[model samples]
Target: MIVSKRIAAVAAAVGLAVTGLAGTAAAAPAASTDLRLIAFNDFHGNLQPPAGSSGRVVLSNGTTVDAGGAAYLATHIAQLRGQVKNSLVLSGGDNIGASPLTSALFHDEPTIDFLNQVGVSASVIGNHELDEGYQELLRMQFGGCHPTDGCQFEKPFRGAKFPFVASNITFDNGLPAALPVTIKFVDNVPVAIIGVTLHDLPSVVTPEAIKGLKFGDEVQALNKTSRLLDLAGIRTQVVLMHQGDSTEGGGPDDCRTLPGPARDIATRASASIDVFLTGHSHQQYNCVVTDPAGNPRPLIQGASFGRLLSVVDLKINKRTGDVDRSATVAHNEVVTRTVTPDPTVQALVDKAVTLSGPIANRQVGTITADLTRTASPAGETPLGDVIADAQLAGTQGNQAVIAMTNPGGIRTDLVYATSPAGEGNGVVTYGEAFAVQPFSNIMQTITLTGAQLKNTLEQQWQASGTKFLQISSSLHYSWSQSATQGNRVSNITVNGTPVDPAGAYRVSVNNFLAAGGDGFAELKNGTNLAGGPVDLDAFTAYLTAHPNLAPPASDRVTVLP
Candidate 1:
C-alpha cells in the first residue's frame, strides 16, 4: 500500500496502523486497494499568492506559514498524488467568483484554465458560483465564451474539464441543475462522489441570480443520493459539500470540537457515505463525526484560498465494494511555498498578470491608512463606511440621502503597503480596489418611508446571523443589544435631524441589497427604484476623485448595551 511519510507519522502518533491493518483482528485483506483524495476549497481564483493573512495557514504547533498560489498548490497536489498509486483531486467549492483582479478582470477564465490543468476530477457548486448567475456557471462547465464579453483571452474559452455537481439545486422543472454524482473507479471499485451546496443559498446570492432555482435540504439530498448510489452497487461514497461550519481557533488538524452545519449534516447523513469534504466557512478542521448508523468517518475542511489541502487516505475493500471506515485517515496539510512551484501553472499566472497589467496597475487614489472590513463593537467597518459613501456619491444625482451596503460584499481590506505591482506605499491601484469590491454589483437608489428605513436596519439581525449594513456618513442610528430582534434598532437620524417615520427618504444600496439579498427584505419594499453606475466603477471613481482618502470613522452606528 502507498502511504506518504506524513500520513505514516500521523497514523503512528494516533496509535493506528497504516500497513497490514494492525488494529483489526484479521490482517489478510488481499482484495483491498489504497486510494488517496486530495481536496481544497474556496480558491476564489487566486492565481497569484494571496497577500497578507489570507495566504497564511496556522499549524498545529501554533506557528503560521505562508501558503497558497495556483502554482504552489499545483506542486503540493502533485507531491501528495505521487504518494499513492490511485488518487483523485477534488474541490469542495468557491473555486472561482470573488477573485483577484488578475483573474476577475478576465471573468475568471484564467482560474478555469488553471483548474483544468490541475486535473480536478469534480467539484461542488459554491454559492459564489451563482454570483454571475446559474447560466454563467453552466458556461464555466460546458466551455464557451462569455455572453457579454466574448472570448477575452488568447485562446477560446474552454470550460472546466471536470464536472460541477450539486444534488440539491434544481430548476423550475424540478430537474437537477448540475450532475448530482460522479463515479470514479479505483482499482475497479466504484466510488461515488456527491456534491451539494448550502440549502440557504438564495439568502446569500443576489435574488435575480437564483430567480428560478430551488435549494433543497442538504442532509436529505445527500441521503437520497447515497441510497441511489447504493442501489447501483456504488457503496463507497464521498461528499463534496459547499456548506461548512466554524470552530473557535484551532490548527489545521485539530478537532477538539466540531460545531456547525457540517457536523449536523454528517451526524444525519447516511452511513453509506464514507467521507465528507466541506467548504464555504473558510475554516480549517480535521474531524471524525459519527454517521447515522454510528460509523465514524472523516469530516474535513481546508482553510480557504488554497492555504491548506484536505487529504483523506482510504482503504477500499474490493470484495465488499466499500471503504474500511476504521482504516480511513484524514488531515489538513498546509500548502507551504517552500517547494518548487509548477512552472507551467506559474506561466499561466504570469500571462494573466501581463494581460491585465495595464488596467489593473493604473493608480486610482491613495489611502492614508488601511481601510479594512474589521468590524467594531457596533458592527461598522472603515472600508464598509467608505463603500457606502461611494455608492451614495455615485447616486447623488438621484438625491439619495442615505446609502447602505452589506458587510459581506466587502471582500478584502485596502492595505497601504506597496503591492507586488511595486506601486508606491499608500498608492491604491485599480487592481487593489477591484479586490476589495469584486462583485461588480450595480448601484441602486430607492424611496422609503423613515419607518421603512428603520425596518431595513432591523433586518440586519436575522435568524442566520447579524449582517450589519455599512451606512453613509449622512445616516446614523443606534441599536440596543438588550432589546428584542425587530425592536433593537432605534434613535434613528439622518444628517443631524430626527427621522420622521412618516417622512419619505431616499436611500442608496447595491443592486443585491436593493433586491433584498442577505435577508434584508425591507429594502425590497422601497419604491421609485433608480439605477446608477456599477458598484466597482462608483468605488474607483470615488477613489480617483478623492486623492488622499482617509479611513472613515466607525462612529456612525451607536451600540447600546
Candidate 2:
C-alpha cells in the first residue's frame, strides 16, 4: 500500500512518473552523475515484529513483495548505496524512547546499539528523547554514572552510537554542550542536515523531563543555520524534522493527504533545503513540496514504530553537485510484517527479548472495560479524561475544581479487560501499561479565571486538530463552529449550573499543555498557583488501586452552540 509521486524534470520539461507504480530503474551512467540519499523518521523503538497481522506490501502492479525490519532496511540501504557512488542515511528524530517494552524497559539502550550497527549517519533528537530527564538524554548519548536498578540481569547500558542533532535547543547554565547543528559530509558530499524537535516540548512533554531546557523557534533556527551552511559551501541540504501531519488509512501503506507542521514550515522555508524527513504524527507520505522559494523539494515519512521505511532516492547532478534536475527519483518501501524477520535484526531483538524475558512477561494491571482513545463526540476522549482524572487525584488538594489533559499525552489504545489477573499471565502487565504511558510526566495544578478557561477552549479551533480539553469532572460549555473561533464556548458551568467568567478556578493538567505548548494560548496565561506531584506516579497509583476500573461514561465536557 505504499504510495509514491515521482516528479522527474529534465530542464523544466517535467514528466510525472507513473503513479501507483514503481519507476523503471534508470541505467547507471559510467562515472555516475547521480548521488543517492535515504532517510526515515519517528521510529519510536519498535524493535520486535509489529502488533497484528503480517503480509507482503503490494505495489499497484500485480507483482508481489516483501519489506522492512532493521536488517531488511539495512539490506535495502546497502543495495541502494551499491548503485550510487555516494549515499547518506539519516533520521527525522524520535528514533529512541516512548517505544515498546523491548526497547523502552531498558531506556532505549538496545535501540541505540542497533542504530550503531546500522551505520545511521546522523539523527535529529525527537521530543521523546527528552521523555526522560534531559540528563537521561545525556546518559543515552554519552557515558554516565549508574547503580544497577532492577536491571541487574541485563547488560550494563552502553552509550549512543552517533551524535544526536538539535540546533535550536539550549541548556541553562551548568549544562553540557548542545548537540551540533549540522553534519558535514557522508562520502564527501558536503550535505548539511538541520535537526529540530517541536518548539512546544516544554508544554508537550512531562515538565520533570524538560524542566531545565528551552526549545527555540524551528523555522528561525533552520533559516539561520541553512544560511551558515550555504555560506560554508554545503549545497546538498535536508531537514530531519520531527514535526508531522495527519493521515487516513487502515494500514501502513495508505497514502497521506493532510500535512502537519512539516508541510507548513517546509512550504515557507528558504531554498537551501532539498528534502524533509518528518515524524511525530505517525502518518505516511511520499510527495514533493515547494518551499517559499518556489523550488520543488522532496519529502517522505513512514508510519511510526518501524511499520514502514521511506526510501527517498535522490540523484545529485555530478556537474552541479546538487539534486539532478533531470533524474530525481523517490518512493517509499512499506515494512510489511509477513517477511521473515531479517536474521541480523531478529538476532539482535531475540537477544534483547531474552535479556528482557522477566520484565516483558510480567503483568501490571487490568481494565474492566474498553479504554479507547479515539476522539469523543465533543472532540475530547475518555482516555484523555481518565488520564486527567488520575493527574487530579494524584494531587492531594481539597479545592482542585477542574482538570485538563492533552490528547497527544495518551500514547496507546487500551481494550476492555475481562478480569483482574496475575503477573505475566494476566489481562495486562506492568510492561504493557508502562509502554502505554512511558513518559515521566508529573501532574500540575494551576489557577485560572473562568474567562481564561473560556479562552483555552476557544484556542482549540484557532488551529484545526488541536487537542480539545478533556475535563476530569463536570465543566460545561457550548460552541458553534459556524460562529467565531474563541467565542464558540457558551453555557459555561462547573458543578452544574454555570461558571462565572470572572471567578477563579483551580485546574489540574500535565506540565506540557500548561506552558502554552501545542498552540493552546490560554494555558500559557494561567496563573501557576502551585505545582506538585509526578503525573506518571499518579497514573501508576490509579492503575494499582483500581485494577478493574471501568471507563466512566458521564461525558461532562462538551462542544456546543
The candidate that wins on TM-score is 1
lDDT per residue for candidate 2 within 1-561, as digits (tens), equals 221111112101211011121122346633323446567677777666433211134354434444445556656556666676556677778888767667876777778877777667678888888877777788777754344453432355667766678767876763323554544443333456667777766655656677777788888868866776565555667788888877654333344557467788788876888888888777667767887767787667776666566666666543344765335566666655444445776688777777776776565566776666667667766667777677777765736777777776666655543212224222566555655576655567788898888888777774547567677765666767567756677877887858778888888876777767667767777775577576666776777777776777746655554
Each candidate structure's TM-score, on Cα atoms with residue i matched to residue i, is 0.92, 0.78
Give model 1's TM-score versus the native structure. 0.92
Which ranges of candidate 2 are over 4 A from the true structure? 1-36, 49-87, 145-156, 170-188, 200-202, 206-216, 247-260, 354-360, 368-370, 396-401, 416-426, 447-449, 502-506, 514-516, 519-533, 544-554
What are the lDDT figures for the candidates, one per model? 0.87, 0.65
Give the C-alpha lDDT of model 1.
0.87
lDDT (tens digit, per residue) of candidate 1 on 1-561: 344354344333322221121122236546788889999999999899887677778877888999999999999999998888788899999999999999988889999899989888889999998889888998898888888888888458979888888889888898777777776766656677789899989888987888899999999998887776665666788999998877777899988544578889988988899999999988898999888788899889998988999999999888888888889999888899999999999999999999999999999999898888788999999999999999999999989999999987887788888888899899999998998889988898999999999999999987656789999999999999999978999889999999999999999998888878889889999999999999999999999999889997788999998
**What TM-score does prediction 2 earn?**
0.78
Candidate 2 structure lDDT? 0.65
Give candidate 1's error at residue 159 in angstroms.
Answer: 1.4
